[model samples]
Target: MHGQTTFLNWNKERIALERIKSLDPIAHGYMDTPYYVAYSGGKDSDVLRILFELSGVKYDLVHNHTTVDAPETVHYVRSIPGVIISKPEITMWDLIVKKRMPPTRIVRYCCTELKERGGQDRFVATGVRWAESVGRKAKRNSLEIISPRMKDKIVLNADNDESRRMFETCSLQGKRVLNPIIDWTDDDVWEFLRYYGCRSNPLYGCGFKRIGCIGCPMAQDHERLRVFGRYPQYRAIYIHAFNRMLAARRADGLPTDWQTEQQVFDWWVHSTRRRREVEDQIRLSEVAI
Candidate 1:
């Protein structure tokens, strides 16, 4: 019985190692080419970096600086060896001033400028998983050829249908994108991290679920509250932007339902109050240090 148990444990370990090796082989084969890893210093990216190291794949570690990233994220990226931080020519503040409003999911101008074009002219690698978001889930696991115009360079046309479509699109003029972890699940990511004893961003330990733009529209209200409380500078910027947006709307004679800068400030203040009230009721609240 003891022998059988030991054999089963060995087999499980072997299977795990093989699964990691498979990903390594795929990445190793792509070495000798210019590729950049779109690292965000999150759990997923941490696992991706480990896999790259284990596979001995040569690639650049690139982090796109939105200028509005969490300080913790910035610190984490800086700690990683050989990471190159790339910032947009025009910042989110500039975009907000020009557009006269904060970004919404329906109008995600941030993604195109801050993210999509951040790693242009290089084969980009991401730890995108289909299970993470509905849109990402639609993406395939292999390399997809995009237009050079879309990314500021023209690359070779490939035989795949996705590549063909990309060749036709003026936006993808000469770029190729690679997604190595497209099939991974949330649980798979945690399991891999546990197996490899990988290090994740400290923000996760502090109750941050997602790390992106400070005031991302996709973030929950609780997240916004946490950010507002934790990062005063970011909160001040958002409040200023909201005020400017309110003024623009009024000047343009647009709809009047928009929240003013003062209102936003009040909401942030009240959110903290509400949190305190809830915590007091439950007796589980710990003050922010």
Candidate 2:
């Protein structure tokens, strides 16, 4: 598996290197700041780090410690030298209690507050691929100007990058990012990683496909259940946090159907409909506020 890039006739590796080298100037103008590479302790981030090194560009591999990441992921991230571990001020458990709600697919406030924080006003690099999800492909771009307001985000595709000078200006107000592997396939990622002899996160060896947060809302029921089974302590932590959240709600005269943390935990892990309803209720409450 290690020397298969040529047997597969893979050229995206070369393309990715070119993309990073080409985008190097965006990292520094008169400033000495380099690209903030978002390293998530996943295979893609590993590939991105390797590509940056191969391209010989200045970059800092930064991992946003969501506090809910699997033990394996944290350990994997630590094993990588020069990776800047950026921990959030608040842990996921505390965040759930503070928000008085669990993170759901409809509104993952946790992601905004934890995983997607940092790299502000700096050029960034991510290993996001269109193959991951349709939502990402639709929202993310090869080159993007981060907006103070997300709705006003600026996307400069390879063809539209002629306005790069203007795109550089937008970075002054917010940030900019380049997705070097935006067009790469899953095969491309695994092939490139193998060629570089990267075994990636240990979770992958244990039959885990995606290794990010332990109980991400984005994960399917079976995947969540599997991770929880492997690390039941995380389930306990979440339930305990939910109990605190319910307590907070009651103290504030907020409405909730969950009488016990067990009830909330079951709904969180099993009931997608209930979670969506809660998200809707949350949105309504915000409107009322």
- What's each prediction's TM-score? 0.68, 0.89
How well is each residue in 161-278 modelled by candidate 1, as lDDT tens digits?
5653443343433455656666666776776676666667888899777777787765666777677778888778877877876787788887765466877556544554566578
- Residues 3-95 of candidate 2 have per-residue lDDT tens digits of 644525257777777667766754446335888999998988888988888887888899999999998888889999899999898999999
> lDDT of each model, Cα atoms only?
0.65, 0.83
Question: What TM-score number comes out for model 1?
Answer: 0.68
| C-alpha lDDT of residue 185 in model 1 | 68
The C-alpha stretches of model 1 lying farther than 4 A from their native spots are 1-33, 148-172, 245-259, 263-289
Off by over 4 Å in 2: 1-9, 26-31, 159-165, 169-172, 273-289
lDDT of 2 at 78: 95
